[model samples]
Target: MTVLYRRVLGAALDDLPPQLLALHDSADPRTWSGQARIWRGAGILSRLIGWVMRLPPQGDAVPVSVSFIPQDGGEVWQRDFAGHTFMSYQYQAPNAQPGIVNERFGMIDVTVAFQTDRDRLVLEPMAWAFGPLPLPKALLPTGQSFETQIDDRFVFDVEIAMPWVGQIATYRGWLLPTE
Candidate 1:
């Protein structure tokens, strides 16, 4: 049977790395959940930032889920971390720049660069903006990494830091499709 893969982030479903595509192209789409060993970076400021974001306190494992719904030009990614939902809007315009995934976190515009590294697909934050004003990238501390294990499970590690605030928050976890 031929499987239909939907666009994720901004890359065409078929153009994505094979392994990465398989992860998103599951038998069921309505609901998916998994568990991971969640971790919060050290330092008081990092913990404070985590609290503000509503991230679960440093835990060995936590539950996460994503509800993906197709829209006119893109998809709605509603992510449930631990239990809090961080909603984001994603879309791809007809003439969008190559390798760019445009997303809106609340009112902030976030642009991410999508690329393939070996067998993994990586998403790197490129820029951010509020309304029509663009924010200086140099003033933001950002990091991104995503990889799929040999067994088909996925692992993600992301961190955001500020100049004097040091490492704001970092979380890493593995996830698998729930049957």
Candidate 2:
């Protein structure tokens, strides 16, 4: 069966590295764990936003785990970063072209576009909404978000920055299939 990521990525799915492909290839629910370094902005607005988003605290080599639960046509990702858990549901974007996916964290939903830079699978936030209200494009977080195979594991680096608030959160890490 074609999985959620595979359906959204379409032909680009073939370009993924072995590790990335392995991570998204499965149709069954599974979990992955690894270590990560996390950071957050110092500004009050950034902190408030981060808190609302349930962002993890700053730490080095923090243990991280993510559970992927496949739903009807979407997938729910439950992530545990040092026991501070947050979840997001992802699926093909409604009324969007292929290579675009929608991710929802609580009341916030963001449409993401896929791109390939060298060996990395880059996720770019195209649009975002808080609840039913569409937010300004300037408020949408941007920066680096990509996944790649580092050695034998799947590695990810995600840096989220706003217009004037600057970087709100960042986490870099690697994941291996939980045995």
Candidate topping lDDT = 2
Runs with alpha carbons beyond 4 Å of true place in candidate 2:
none
1-179 in candidate 1: lDDT tens per residue?
Answer: 22223443334545555545656554344445666555565788877866665565555667878676655555576878777677676765456676567777666777777776666667787888876788888755476555555555656666666666676666676656556
Candidate 1 segments exceeding 4 Å error = 1-19, 23-29, 41-56
Clashes of 2: 0
Report the C-alpha lDDT of model 2 over 10-31, residue by residue, as the tens digit: 7777788988888887799999
lDDT of each: 0.63, 0.91
* TM-score for each candidate, following the candidate numbering: 0.75, 0.96
Q: How far is 177's C-alpha from truth in model 2 (Å)?
A: 0.2
TM-score of 1: 0.75
Q: Who wins the TM-score comparison?
A: 2
Q: What is the lDDT of residue 55 in candidate 1?
A: 60
TM-score attained by model 2: 0.96
